[model samples]
Target: MSIQKIALVGNPNSGKSSVFNQLTGLNQHVGNYPGVTVDKKTGSFPGKEGGKIKVIDLPGIYSIYPKSEDERVVFEILKDKGHKNYPDLCVVVVDVTNLERNLLLFTQLHDLKIPTILVVNMVDLLEGEGISVDLEKLSELLGGVPVIPMNARKGEGIEALKNAIYDFNQTTWTPFLKQYATHDHGLKHLPSPSEQIEDTDRRFKKITQILKFCVKRAEPSKSRKLISNRIDKVVTHPIWGYAIFLFILLLIFQAIYELASVPMDLIDNVFLLLSQGTRDALPPGVFTDLIAEGIVPGIGGIVIFVPQIVLLFAFIAILEETGYMSRVVFIMDRLMRPFGLNGKSVVPLISGVACAIPAIMATRTIDQWKDRLITIMVTPLTSCSARLPVYTLLIALVVPDKSVWGFMNLQGLVLLGMYLLGFAAAFLAAIIFKLIIRSRQKSFLIMEMPTYKIPRWSNVGITLWEKTKVFVWEAGRVIMAISIILWVLASYGPPNRIEKAVSAIPIPENVADDAKMSYEEQVSSVKLENSWIGLLGKQLEPAIAPLGYDWQVGIALITSFAAREVFVSSMATIYSVGEDFEDEATMLQRMRQEVNPRTGQSVYNLASGLSLMVFYAFAMQCMSTLAIVKRETKSWKWPLLQLVYMTTLAYIGAFITYNLLQ
Candidate 1:
């Protein structure tokens, strides 16, 4: 069967992605566009007579004459004829309730002369507002393009939309191009205009003509204005809004801790069983130990947080769907202005909870270069899910397992404080950056406050599932690979090293069996300081020693750069090698019991625990974030700078904390 490509394009909050998801269902793959951080979501659908259709969801934009980096990406892709993966058909999704504003992009697409099918989404919203669009007249005015009115959320008009796509032909849509040229002469030129006036004028003329002919409203959307005003009163108020936002944030953090515990415990126990079963089934050997202790536990460390990650995404998706996120941006914009950020930066900064890479990528929405750069630089300060395992484990070890104020978990509050510290750091850095780089360009915030809609459970579920799955698969691959490598590194030693040492030491005859032990047994039975890993660990002991880390902690630190969560796995791998511990909790308890050989003091006291948490909180410890920064900035300069600066800060902070506590 032939493969036909369809691209979904729409303004932000126009239900473009919802339409894509409804049509494609579970058949989508998300990855970066060939050379950009802009997400490329492609999916397949069964076409008429068994033909296959490929659909691409382009980033939302206001116009083809782009303003922000993300909007420019949409224009770049649509205009580049030489680009691979060009769309064969363009499905321009417009919210029927806001046709005048939504049709701006549709008219731009028609000017591009792409095979266009107009999808008037949110038709259900029109009738409720006492507004109605004449489909036939609108279709005729749009130059004979197939116009399908769809309620994308309810699956209404989807079959007709699919048929429209299957029957799409460029030849049938030339009149729309002709009409645009005749009515909006600014669009007719030999090549794309160079000056800002010419470009903006052209887009404005084209959109104005489209709205004049095709759109009619019963009355201005009073509800949109009224609800926006009402919500804005409480949410964007200088005093109350900030307080409410903080309370909401705290509630989410507390809930994440409380709700995720049961599922996390179940996952931990399941993995423990798997490891124990592997150990019991296999012969007592190095390979068996690697599988049971290193690989299983290492992978399990990342997998256990899937529940929490999903919950985070779920809350975010619901906020977005309900149009509350826009209010958040509006409320925070005034406050963020002093910090060289706009309201839009709130989305990316909040998204940093999932991962800094995507959050940094999302900064493309910021129009100003200085604002975008500062946002990208400081977004990593927001605590990501990768930090959760480390924070959870350390908090459990230090904070008592009890609640305060009859509602807040003490450990959860500590976790909440860590997140707040990250936010505080981001704000401080942004303020400093703003002061250092002064630009006088006035960028106004023009955001569309969409009508609040009830949260669609299916949509929210799909979003949460997709995000959590990506986190698991991407992070899991790196963790599992690193675990195997670490296992090998810690397993073997120089030849005759153990035997020679044993021979040199005088032993009683009654303990001959202990002396004649096998190589694996001797390696496992020996103290870590006498092993190869221990030697390497000791070599770095001097460097991190002032930061309250022993050689073993230094080893974990070195390995954790692969990912922040790997700290837990590294500790598990190191501790599980010769011990009989069955699970992570037991292993953590054993670590706390460990004493420094020279000082005869506990290894993981309050000082060391605080230092480690501070280090992870500040350090650029994830290779994934670095790789993404390199990809986005297209230079080693930024990521390298990020790594160096963050690592220095982490070192200084850890050093201070350690010394003060000691």
Candidate 2:
């Protein structure tokens, strides 16, 4: 037999992704479908007789009938046989508890005459809910389409599901909707989306009739929803709910600060030694300088923060897998509605903590045009993982590492404060946009609360792996290139200008041996100040001077336009070029000891460090985020305005912070 292609279709929170994960394990690939931003997941697994079956995990939707562009893309791919991702067989996974609602999608697929299998999932919850399914009878009712009862989390029924996939064929079958299936193939003849509601009502009526015979329900001995409802009383409490969320945020930040310090220090020292060793092992030349100063330390600058980032992603993944994040959305809706944000806006806003790009993409679910535009414009204000390094670096530089009340890490408290500030800024910005932008659509929050369960560790592991891979690979390339370019600019200058400046620095005629080394250091500093990057930084210094930043900080502000994390790497490469790599001092130490030549004061003092942190908190420093905004809004006008407004806000915020601290 030929290799079979299968598609997994289901409603949200139906354990469809879990089924895909169980089947594909580590063989999955994530990509976008042609001409759209929606993710397309494909993987291969062994079928019966050791043949391979290709599986596509389509995005979750309630139905195939299009109500939005994303839904349209998914609908076309499923309905069109000529489409590249069209499958030979379709697997509809459904939550047995909510079978009526989920079966709507399955019935639509069935009536399309697609060779399909029905996977009745989450059967483990059946006993708790006092429900049972007559699997053989249900298959007989659907004209003998294969039905596999499954508990995907525990890997149960996977073998049976595989067998059903291989056994599927286009037999003469009775569709759930007979009349619609006969003339129109279920939905092909609908004049427009305005009429889908009538057809949907008819399908639900038939589904209600079918469920009456093939399913049984009674008062539960112990309802799982009862336990969940009890938990929700405390979790969704108006006051305590927000308190618990804040407490959780506190613990996550504290863990990040307390646990990551040792690993971060280790990484910092390892790179220092590696840079020194590279210099020692290779001939003293420009290539050696480039490797020892540019590439190694640049990548290390971002890599040192990976431990903290991993901890953040892990906590988020675990929260999501446990179904608590939905509660967060449910509670936050009340708080957000006043700010002109839909309850659905909470998902993208919360997701923005990881990265703004996907978070912006997540806004596609918001139905209101004005709300989505506002969310896109303000989401970058959230403190994403890209800003974590910048925050941790500055906080460490200015805030003393100690306990507040002998329990809380003072530094972690500061870090949490930065995130809180991001949310506040986003909300305040949303209010302003609400006043300025007009829309006729009324907002509402409609969502499902899944029964809470112990988090699936396999899901958490995969999340960490994918997030880490993207962070390293995407950020690494930009940092490496910028570092190389900065190194060349800092290492060389116009003609003999660098040589003339260095040669002009006179060694004291009767200097002590120790002071001779100091004289050589002065010459190196003179050479660096005359180099190309230094001149560029010097030109920018005047514009940024009121914010308490020096020329070096100005250079970082400029390069950070590529990505927020590049700020740290920019500093690392800049300092590495003019310093002695053989010293045991790490980049953080050098930053601490950095002094202004003119003022005779530390460069990264509290006022300047705090100013820099505030600048980063509000700045639109990411080009990729801008490109995505343009694509999502379908115009250059909004992104350009976003860049202008955010940059202006950052400057004013930083100025006030610096002056007040001083």
Candidate 3:
């Protein structure tokens, strides 16, 4: 009844997580290993009447020897006794469908000499494919260690596996012993070992001999070959594969805009109603204004994108699960070779849609230093969810609310265009960077193409929910804080002067029922020229004038660098002061009508709108991205270079667009 710990380890795409989910159910917590960003998942199950079992879901790794950073973490944890926790038992999850390759990792675990269980998962696929694994013989050959066959998807053989874990005893199953372990067969032979080394070596040899005896494959099934041939015909064709990939990407963008619009609208209206209700229920004061205007609007801006974020992640998960992502890497590799990037960079580039920070961090998988650096440099140009708000607002401002081809919304098309622009910029930048930074080695691509399977809806749902939750929570906090500060900055004016100026404005007798004055008239009566924010805006006017932006636009440009979405909240906070704008949309509408005192023309002309969009499209506007870049690169060099390069590009782009329009 001693507390026993079990660790689940497996190859990527081996359904190791499915096994963990089956064993642990909902009683689990996912976190990071101490001092590392790699995910650590743990859960406990009742063993006997009162005894309990602890299960740890280790990160999926291809080999214990370790090549990538994530894979190295697994090796370090298993090898180093100094690590906080050690498992009493290791459950090596093997894909029965791909046993030869999967067993490579299993042999490594056996060498560790931890009490072990081999879970041959996906047994259901064996019969249909004319492959059969002899379970009893396999168990007997592997020194009597339990070998359970399971179809994790259908909940088959789970009880037996649980029972095996509960009753597991090292003495009950004789350790397998043989010469030439599968993984170590190609390596140089080691000298005769001491007692501890000899014991571990015997265990590994036994596991290997058992694997060779028990595992059987029907002579090279033609299914994989046939599927690969058919897929390669179109997907890896010189021309068609690239075209198809681009088309699929366009389809994803279209789906994100059209499918998520209904839910986004629903969220927008709900938050708006909630804000109005709060205003009516609360006593009138600065507190009410602050809550209703600053906090609510700021947070609402981020919440509105939840539906879109979910849809994006859902689509990405589906792509990854179906194994099409590998083909994408295959196709992109050919296309990216000229740009000096490996094909695998496609994963991080695709992930940049969620956020650049994680996408940049994902470059750890790329082995080449030059490729990794170039990917990190240009990844920000991929339109992240943070940019979605800016694109949404600007597209709404400019594009007509009409549909084309009876399906595509005009606004959606514009949004799609912006995404394409970002993609094009990233590709071009990669090409330029490749040409500039010379590397000696010609890196070759080698990617495992996993078998295609229908995506699990449950997995997709959980992934979408978790990712959207993080976006809402992290972005929500920043927006709320900025909104409150902006509200205060805009609401309070210069010392005494503005208040005296407001009192001096004459009221005509004809409209002398001052309480009945329209919200517009009340705002117009205020001496906004003397207000602190107004003065600050005016001072920035000269600096922004070349870009066709007025002082108010300058204020928005300054605040937006904290986060692109904050531009909308900053404008809302600015416009709400001295005016009774009912909502964010009204604030935008009012902004369009405001005239420049110097030019006697509308402040938001076509030139300024174009300038604003161009600026946001290229700016390093997310603080989260900067922090993540710093952490991932472990140096200020890359992040600082990103900040300088992106800001310079944004300025030049905006300046050119503004000058052309003017």
Candidate 4:
């Protein structure tokens, strides 16, 4: 038998994704939807008859009628039968707890004549809630559609769902719902805004009649829903909520510093050894130099940060899975509104901590144009994971590692403060945009809060794996390419410039071995100063001098425009080129020893290190983010304005920081 396609659709928080995960395990990949930048997730599994079953998990929506980009994508695919992604069958997943609201989209699918299996998820909550559902009766009422009760978190009903898909033809078919059946169900025939409201009322009336006979309920214990409400009372408390969130952030940063140190050290040492080993194993030439000095250390600079990145993602996944993130959004809505945003803007802002690309893409969910545009403009101000490596490196260089306040690591405290600073800057920028931008549409938030439950470890693990993979794979490619290019520019100079600079270094004939090695080092440094990249950095030096940055720092500032995280790799590539790799000193040790020849001061002193950190915190350094902003807004004006304002902010902030500390 040929392979068949099945799509999983549901309202937000309806456990649809859990069902998809249960069915497809690790056989999935994420890509963009056709002709759009929205994510498309597809996976496949073997069926009972040994045929393949492909599954596409569409974006969650409340109705078939389009209101947002996500809904429009879903609507386009489902309404067109000839569309390549049009599924052979559809599985409308629903939360057993919120059946009526979730079924709104299912009825629309039914009326459109798409074969669908209604998967009633989270059925395990039924007994505890003193509710009973008759699966057979519900199926009969729904025109003989297959209704499967599932606990997707525990992998229940997966086999039954697969069985239904395999034998869908054997099931009886019935006429569409009488009211919606009158139309041809084509794109041009879609009901207007007012007509949609009336049709929705009719669908609900019919759904309520079906539920009245098939569902029986009784008053149950106050342990679940009541407990959730009680917890929310404290967690969403205006005063306590912000405090709790800050405490959580402090703990997370401390864990990142404490727990990840061992592995990060191990990775650093391994890569150092790899670079040294490659140099020893290969013949001396440009190829060997590129591998050891350029590619190895560059890739290592990024890979070493993986441990910290994993912990960050793990915490985010746990928060989302335990249903606390929604409450966060709820609590933040009031604070967000005054700044020309609502609760919905909170997701993109918080998600920006992961990456600005998807965070900007997430704005598709916000319906108001002015609000979405403002959200996109400020989202990048949130210090993302890309900034973590830079922050940690600079913090280690300047801040003491000792504990403050009896237990809190000072370094972790500084990291938290940086994140808080980013949040403050974002809010301040939102205020400015609010004043400048005009909009008549009033913004509001209507969201559902899910009952709190222990996070599913399987789901958390999957999220960790996917997020880490993307960070490494996407970042590694850019870092590797830049590393090689930088190595070339740093290793070789224009014509005879490098040779003349090196030959000009003077040495005594009867010098000691130490003095001879010193002469060699001096010659290397002089040659590097005249290299192609060096000349470029020198050209930028005058512009950045007031910010306490040298030509070397200027080089990194330039290369890192490709990506924020590449700053570390760029530094690694710059320092490693035209230098001895056999030394036992680590990268940090090398950086510590660097000094300004003219001033005779440590290059990475407190003033400069802190200044650099502040610069990265506010800079518009990532080209990917700029391109995404242009795509999302469909105009160069917003992104261009964003780049100018942010760059100016970074320069002024760095200058003030450097001058104050000096």
Q: How high is the CA lDDT of each candidate model? A: 0.78, 0.88, 0.75, 0.88
TM-score result, candidate 1 = 0.90
Write the residue-wise lDDT of candidate 4 on 426-463 in tens digits. 99999999999998988779889887879999988887
C-alpha lDDT (0 to 100) for residue 411 of candidate 1: 78
lDDT of 1 by residue, 1-662 (tens): 13388889998889998998898987888998776788989898998878679999998888877666777677777776555766887899988777777776787777676778889889878755767777887878777878998888878888999887766655544534343454332233334556645655665676567667655667656766687578778876889988997888788878888899899888878877888888889999978988987898788777777777777788889888888888888877888877778667887898898789899999888777777777888889889988988888787666687989998888778888888888888898788777876787656677877777898787887787688878888888888888888777666556766556545554445656556444424445454555677678889999998887889888889899988988888877777666554434555566776777756778887787888888888899988888888876778987898888889878988899889998
Estimate the TM-score of every prediction.
Answer: 0.90, 0.97, 0.87, 0.98
- Please state every model's RMSD to the true fold in angstroms: 3.9, 1.7, 4.6, 1.5
- Cand. 2 Cα-lDDT: 0.88
Q: On residues 443-557, what C-alpha lDDT tens digit does candidate 2 reach at each position?
A: 8989999888899898788778878888999999999999999889988889999988888887688678678778867876787788999899999998998999999899889
> Candidate 1's C-alpha lDDT?
0.78
Ranking by TM-score: 4, 2, 1, 3
After the best TM-score superposition of candidate 4, give how far the Cα of residue 608 lies from its true spot, in angstroms.
Answer: 1.1
Clash pairs (backbone) in predicted model 2: none
- Of 2 and 3, the candidate ranking higher by lDDT: 2
Write down the worst ten-residue block by lDDT for model 2. 182-191
lDDT of model 3 at residue 62? 72
